[model samples]
Target: MTTAATDLRADAEATLQRLAGSGAQLREDQWRAVEALVAHGRRALVVQRTGWGKSAVYFVATALLRARGKGPTVIVSPLLALMRNQIEAAERAGIRAVTVNSANTDDWQAVYGEVRAGEVDVLLVSPERLNNPEFRDQVLPELSRTAGLLVVDEAHCISDWGHDFRPDYRRLRTLISELPEGVPVLATTATANDRVTTDVADQLGVSGQGDGALVVRGELDRESLHLNVLSLARGADRFAWLAQHLDELPGSGIVYTLTVSAADELAAFLRERGHAVTAYTGKTDPADRERAEDDLLANRVKALVATSALGMGFDKPDLGFVVHLGAPQSPVAYYQQIGRAGRGVERAEVLLLPGPEDKDIWAYFASLAFPGEPQVRVALSVLGDAGRPLSTAALEPRVELSRGRLEMMLKVLDTDGAVKRVKGGWEATGEPWEYDGKRYLGLAKARRAEQQAMLDYITTDGCRMEFLRRQLDDPGAAPCGRCDNCTGKHYDPSVGEDVRVQAQEVLDRPGVPLAPRKQWPSGMDALEVPLKGKIKPEEAAEEGRAIGRLTDVGWGPRLRPLMRSDDLAPDAIVDAAVEVLKGWGWTERPTGIVWLPSRTRPALVESFAQRIAAIGRLPLLGALADDAPPRYSDPEDDSEPEPPNSAQRLAEVYGRLSVPVDLDPSSGPVLLVDDVSDSGWTLTVAAMLLRRAGAPAVLPLTVATTN
Candidate 1:
C-alpha cells in the first residue's frame, strides 16, 4: 500500500478505538465510506442498520478532515435526542461538538462564537434551523462556504418519497447547491427503500446531474431484534396484555403509541397498575423530556410510553425491548421505530400489539398530507392579494385549513419557491406553480399500499423480520431464526380474565374535563368580527364535561362512529353521560336543560338532550334556535370548512342562538348540551345567551370533544 494510504488506515484505526473502545475497528464497508469522505472528498450516502455505527464514520471523518485544517463539519440532525447522543459520542472521540436548536436559544450566540473561533470541531443543527430567517440570511451562507463536510442525518427525510418526508429537509437542496465543489457531503439513514434511495441520491446529486453520491448500503437487518406481532380485539385488551406481561420483557425499553393521547393514557394506566413508567410525547416539556430520556437510559424507569416524538434519533445501545400499542401508518415508519431496540444487546424483544383502531389512526394522519390544488390556490390568493407577509395565525382564518396543515403546506410551498417565509410570516413569490396531481396521487397510492403492507405484516404467517426487510427492499431479505413466526411465539397472547376486567373498567370510566375558553383569538375585528379581548366572566360557561375525547383509546372507538351515524347514541353512552352528570359535583343543580342546534346530527343531539332531561328530572327547555342562515352559503361546497377561531366563531354565533321566548327568567341555572365540542365556541356563545336570558349560570355538557 502507498505510504499515505497506510497512514490513513492507521489514523482511522486510532480514531475508531477512541469512538468504540480500545479494541474497536471499522468493518470493510465502514472504512470504505470514511475513506470516500476523508480521502476522496466524495459525497456519500450510507444506508445501514441502526447499530451499524453510522455516526462513527462521520465522527472519524470529522477528526481526520479537521486535522488537515479543513473547516468544522456541520450535521443537520432531525431530533434533539439524536443531537444529544451525537454530541456525547463525538466528545468521546476527542472531538468538540456543539448544538444550536430551539431548546438552547440562549446558547446560540456562544455556540456561534465558538464556531467562528475554530474552537468547535462539529456543529449539529436541527433541519428547521435551515429556514430560520436570521440564520438563513446571516449565518448559512458563511457555513455553506466554510463547512468542511455536511452531514444529513436521517437523510431519508430529504426525499418526498420517504415515509417521513419533512419539507424542511428539502431546503437542504439549496444549501447543497451553495456548497463549494469538493466538500464531502454524507447522508445517512437506517430506513430507506430502493425508491427512496434513488430519489434521495438524485436530490443529493449536483444540480440534477449524473450520480454524485458514493452509495454504501448494507443489509438492513438487526440480528438482535426479535420481532413479533400480537393481534388484540380491542384497545383495552391490548392494554390488559401489556399490564399482564410488561415485567416479563427483557429490560428497560419503550412502549410506542400512534397518538399523544394514547401515550399519556397508556402510561397512566400502566402506572395505575403499579408499573414504573412515564409518558413522553410532543407535549412533554423539553427539560422533562430530557429527564425522562435520562431516566430510561439509567434504568430508573421501566419504560417510556411515547409517541413518534421519541422516535428517529434516540440512541440507547443496550435498550432491552420496544413495544407498540398501535401500528404506525407505514411499515417504513414502523421499521424506523422498532430499529431503536436491540441495538447493543444480544436479543431485544420487539412486539406489536395491533388494535382494531390502528387503521382509523392511520387514516387520520394520512388526511393531513399535502393539500389539494383548490386549497393551495386559496392560500396563494389570500397571500398574494394581501401584499404583505402574513403569519400562519393570521392566514388561518382566511384559509380553509387547520393551522398544522396550513403551516405544513406553506413550508412545502416555500421549498418549491411558490411562497417565501419572511420575518412576519409567508408571502407569495408570484411564481406560477403547477399542482403535481400525478405525483400527489402516486404518494397517496404509495401510502395506501404501505398501510395494506402493515396489515399483511400483522396477519402474515411468514418470518416477521423477513417481511420488514422486504419492505425496505433489502437485498439480503430472508427469514431470521429469531422472530415469533420463525420460532414459536415467545410472548403470551392471552391476558387473565381479571386483568381484562380491570382494563375494561379503566377504559370505560369516562368524563374528560372541558376547560372553558378564557381569551379570544387576536385580530377578530379585522375579520369584521365584533369580539375582542378576554371573555367576560359572567358571559363565559363554567368548566364542563365531555364523555370522552375522540382521540381517547377507551371511548374513542365507541364515540367516533356516533359522529357520522344519524342513529341515537347507544344505551351505554347515555348511561355514561348520566354518570358524568351524577359525579359532576356542581354547587347548584341545574333547573333546566337546553340543547344547541346541530347542523349535521340534529336527530342524535335532540335525542340525547331529551333522554338526559327525562332521566335527571329537570325541566326540558326547548333547543336554542339558529336565527342566521347556514354558516356556509355555498351549497355546492362539499369540503369541510375549517372552524373559525374563538373570536370569529363567537361573532358568527352572537345573534344566532335564541333562547325560548316563553321560558321563565328565574330558571336558576341551566345545562347546555351539544353532540360534540370542537372549538368550544358553539358552547361558549350558547352559554352567554342562556346567562343573559336570566339563568344564573350555564354548564356545558357534550358527548364527545375534538381535541
Candidate 2:
C-alpha cells in the first residue's frame, strides 16, 4: 500500500480541492489537524467540544486521505446508533459510508472484503463487533494489508472513572495495538478530565508528544438554555409541575424518567392530555426504539418519555428542552441528559424534579451501590481465605445468593469504596475499617453519607449548580444565576442578613457551637485542604499568613497576598500571603489549602487557594447552620463548561492521522506527533517527505515513543 506523502498524493490533493471547490470550507483547526495527519504520518488527539463541528475533523480528513489515495478509515464506535448517525451524516455530505454490524452478516463480510481490497474509504463498526476473535484474527488482518486507522469514539469509556463505564472498552487498547504499527489510532470522547486523558493515553500506548497530544476543550455551555430546578415535595407534585409547563414548552423535547413504569405512565398521562407522546425504554425492540428515536428527531412527537439510555447518539438540534423526571444517580448523568437540549443555539429548559420519591430512590440506589457490611465482610473474608482468585460461581455457595446477585453486589462494592474488580476476580481494597467496634460500620457510614447527600439535594434550598460542581470536584464554577432558587424573590435577602452572615456572626463568638465546626476539616476529610483551619486572625495577621483556620482544618485562606508593601490590611495581607504560598506549592489557587499533615501534593497549592476563595463568597453561616438548608444570596454559576481540553479532539485527529514526524521539524508541511507507528502514513509520510524533499532525518518519539 502506498502512503499519501510517499506517493506525492496528487490524487488526494485533487480530491480535497474538488471537495473544497464543491463548497466545503475547512476551519483552521480542522485544516491544521488534517495537515498534521498527512505531514507527520502519525495520529493526533483532537478534542473539540459539541458544536465545534468535530465531525468535519473526521469527515474532511477521511475524505482528504481517501482522495489522496490512502486506504479507508475504519471507525470502531461503541453504539450502532452512532454508526448509523455518522453514516447518514456522511451520506448527506456526499461521502460514501457503510457499517458492519450484527444486523448485516453477508454485507458485513462483503464490506470487510472491500475495505481489505482498498475499495472503501470509511467503515463504521461497534466496538463490541471487534471483540469477536474471528473478526480480529481473520478479517482485521486482511483489512490491515490495505492500511487503515482505528477510531474509538466516546473514548472516556476506556476510563473506569467515566460515568458510562463499559468493561468491553478495556479491550480497545489491545485491538488498536493489533493493527500494524503504521496505522494510527484515534480516540475521542465528549468528556475527559486529566485522569481520563491519562488513562486514554495509557490504554492506547501513546508515547512522548503523541501520548500527550490532545486538543484543549471548548465551553459546553449553551446560554440559550433557561436552566431550572424545581424541588417538589412529592412525585405527584413533580408530575403536576410538568403538566403546568407542558403547554408552555414548545418544540420537540425529551422527558427522561428513572424507571420503565414512569416512562410508560408519563407517556400515557401526556397522551391523555391530548399530546402525541412516545415512550422508549430498554424493553423496546430495535424497530420501536429506532422509530421512537426518529419520531423525536423528526419532531413527529411532541415529547418522548424515556430513560437516559435514549439520548446517547441522537442528535436533534432543535430539541427545546430536556426534563429529568427524577434526580439522576450522579451529576455526570444529570449533565449529559440535560445537554440534549438547545443543541441548535435556541432557548431551552432543563427542568429537574427532585421530589421526596427521588430522595428515596437515590437513597435506595446508594444503598444498592454500597452493600451491607455483612455482605462486604463476607466477600472480603471469602477473598482473604481463598488467597486465590475465586470466580463468582465458586463463591456463590458460600455467599448465600444467586451468582448474578452476588456479582452485582460485588460490582456495587467495587463502585463504592469496598472492593476492587480484577481480571482474576474481586478483592478487598484492604482499606482500614471505619469503626473499631463494628465491622461493617464503615461501609454503612459511607452509604449513609451518600444517601444524606442525595437527601440534601432534594431538601436543600442552596444552589443546585454549586452542589453539582462541588460533587464533580470542580469549584471554579460561580452561581448559575438562573436556577429556581437563584432567581426567585426568596433569594433577595440583604447581603448582611444572608445565611452566611448569620452563620458568620454565630461562628464569630467562641463557644461549644464552634467545636464541631473545628472538626469540619476532619468530618469532610475527602474535601480536606482549602476548607477551614484554626489559626487566629491576630496571629495570621502578624505572621503574614494568608490562611486563618476556622476549624482545625476548614477555613478559607485569608487573602493576605493581595496586600501591598505600602498598604497591608489584614485581609490584603492574607490574600497576598496566599499567592506566595500558592507559588511555593503550599496552597491551591482558586482555593486555599488546609495545613493537613498528610496527602499534601505540591500541585494542589493553587487549587487550595481557589477553594479558600470559593467559601469566602458564601455568607458565613454558623457551624451548626452550615449543614442546614442555607439560603443562597444568589445561585452559583455551574453551567456546562466549554470542553476544557476534552478527549474528542484527540480521537478524531487520530482517526484521520496518517502522518508521523520527529524532531519537531523547523520547517515542514506540519508536525505530527503520534503515540506509535508500525505502518501507515505517519512513518511513510516522514520517510518519503524527507527523502523526496532531501531534508534531514525525521525523528518519531513516543512518551514511550515507539521506534
Candidate 3:
C-alpha cells in the first residue's frame, strides 16, 4: 500500500508541474494544497466559491495522477455542459481528453475503446452516464483492472443540503464501488459547509481510518468586492435605483431575479433606459445560452439580467457587479451566485434589493422542514451503518419519501450539524437526542430551536456573517467582513439626489431644478412620478368648491381644469399631462413603452432610434450561420435564386429596407439602429459582411437581448 501510494504521489506531482508550466498561475497556498493531496497519499476535496479557480485543483490533480501511470482518470460531473467545457479546455491545452455525454454514440465507443486499451489519460463522464448499463458492462470492468482515480466535480450536489440536488448523483457511490479496492477518490465543490465535508468522506467509504481523504478549504475572502443591500418598498423606486447606479458603474454585470418573467421584464426596463442588456433563464435554448455567454464575454452586452439557472461554470472576469433582484434562500446560495463578480482584480459591486415577497418565499421553504429532527435522525442512522455508505441511487428508492422532501430533510440535517455529506454518501454526526429522558418532546424543542436559528438569520438586524455564524453555533468565528451590513455603508437611494442637492444649493429651496453644469449647459432633468392620493376627485372637487365659495378664490387655466375632471382616473390624468410631448414628435408604443422622436434632445433621439431598429432587425437575421455567404441576389426578381437560410435573409432585408447611410461600408461606423437584441444573426452577419467589404469597424448597438 505504501509503495502504491508513493507512486501515485510522484505521478500527481509531475502533472502539477506541467500544468503550472501551461499558463495556470497558482498561488503558494493553492499549490501547497495540491501538493498536500499527493504527499499524504489522500484524495483532496477542494471547496471554494465561484471564480476562485476551483477547476484548477481537479485539473492539476487529474494530470498529476495520470502522469504517474494511472491507467485513466474518470471525472463525474453533473451537467453535460460542464463535461463538454472540460473536454474542450483539455484539448485546447493539448491534453488528450474525451467525454461521454447524451450527444454522441461513436465518441462513446471510441472512449470505451481507449479505456479498455489503457490509452486515454482523462475521461470526463456525467453522473447520468455512469448509470447506463451498456457502458458499465462493456467498459467499466477494464477500468477496475487498471490504476484509476475518480473525480466528482460539483461534489456538493451529493448532499441533499446543496442548492442543486440531482437524484442521479446519489447512485455515484454504487458506481464507484466498481473501482478497484483502495483506488483513490477526489471530489470538488464550490459551496460546502462542515457537515457537507464529512458527508463526502463517508459516502466514498474513506472515513476515520484515513483511506487517503483530506479536506482543503480555500479562503473565502474577496477584498475587491463591495456589497450593498437595499430594503425596498416600491417597484418603480427599485428600478429607479438600478438606473442611477448603472450609469456610474458601467460595464458587464449580472442582474439575478427570481423568475424568467422578472428577468425578461427587468431586461426590458434596463434596455429602455439606454443600457445594452440580455436576459437568460433555464428555458433559454442551450445554443442560445452559449451565444449570449459569448456575446457577454466579447463586451457586446453591457448587462445580463437572468435567473439562478444562468450560473455555474460561466466565467467573465470583468463583471462590474452581481445584483440580486430578490433574496436567495440561504447565504450559501447567495455567496455562490454573487461570487461571479470582481474576478478580474477590479473592485466590483454587489447590490441586493429585497422586498416583502422575499419573506414569504423564504417562509414557504422553511415550512417544508417539519419533523426535521426525526428526519435528520433517520438520515444519521442510515449513514452510521458499518457497510458501504448508500449512494444517491440506493437512497432514493429506499427513503420512501418524495425526492424533494428527502432533499429538504437532508439540508436540515446538514445545516444543523447532525449529518455530514461525503462524495457519494453521508456521515452521521450521532443521532438526535433530547436534554432529558423525554426524547420526543426534547427532539421537538431542538428542532424548533434550529428552525428559529434559520429564521433569525433571515430577519437579522446586525452583521450578516455574524448571524450566519450564530446559526452554525460558531459565533466566535470572526465576521466574514465582506457583506453589505459588515461594510457600514449605504448607497444614496434618491434617484435625483445630485440634481436635487444642486438645485437646493442654487435656489436656496427644497423643490427646484438646479442650474446646468459648465459642460452640460442644459439643466439636469430628473422627474419623480407621483403615487395616487387616497382622496377621490369628487371629494377634492367638493373641497375646492367650498373653499372657493367662502374665499372668492378662483382657479386659473391649469388649476381650474383639475377641479372639473371628476371622472378621470389618476393614471389617465398623468397620461394626459404627457400627451403634448407625444403629439410634438414623441412616440408611445404601449404602456411602459415610450420614446421621444421630436422635442427630445437630438443625441437622445438618435441613440434610442438606432437601438430600437437594431433590436427589431435581429429576428430576421438570426437564421444565418457563420460560414454562410455575405449576400445573395433576390431570385423572385429574376436574379440568382435567393439563399434559403439566414445569410440570404440578411441580404434580402438589406437590399429592400433602408440601410442607414452611416452603416454603409463606404461611409463610417456600422450604425446600430435598434434597442433590443434577441437573436444576433442580423447584426453579426451585417458586421461580418461589412468587414469583408473593407469597413474598418462596425458598431452594433442594441438596448437589450432577449438573453
User: Scored by Cα lDDT, where does model 2 land?
Assistant: 0.50
- lDDT of prediction 1: 0.87
Candidate rank order under lDDT: 1, 3, 2
Per-residue alpha-carbon lDDT of candidate 3 for residues 351-448, written as tens digits (9 for 90 to 100):
77865455444543443433434444554566666355554434443333334566555544554446555555555667563322354365345445
lDDT tens digits by residue: candidate 1, 13-52: 9998998999999898889988989898888999999889
Candidate 3 segments exceeding 4 Å error: 1-41, 103-107, 117-119, 133-147, 363-487, 496-707
Any idea what lDDT model 3 has? 0.53
Per TM-score, the best of the predicted structures is 1
lDDT of every predicted structure (CA atoms): 0.87, 0.50, 0.53
Clash count list over all predictions: 0, 107, 29
Model 2: per-residue Cα lDDT over 1-707, one tens digit each: 34844343443344444543554455666555555555454665654444455555566667766765777777767666677788877765457788888767778778876766666777887765654556756776665555555667777676655556555566666566566656665666555555566667677665236443444344444455666666654344445446545756768899888766567656766675567888898777878888888888888898889876685566777888888877775565565667677877557777776544454445434433324456557767887777676666446535533343476566545434456655555667766544222523643564455456655655567665655545444425456666666676331112222433333332222111101011111111221222234532211111112222211101111111111011212343335333433443212221211111101122233333334435444121111001112111100111312111111211222232222232222242211112222112223323333333322322221111101
Runs of candidate 1 exceeding 4 Å displacement:
206-212, 632-660, 663-666
- Highest lDDT: give the candidate number: 1
**TM-score against truth, every candidate:** 0.96, 0.55, 0.56
- Candidate 2 ranges with C-alpha deviation above 4 Å: 1-32, 46-48, 143-147, 206-212, 359-707
lDDT of model 3 at residue 368? Answer: 42
RMSD of 1: 2.4
How many angstroms is residue 360 displaced in model 2 relative to the true structure, after the best TM-score fit? 4.5
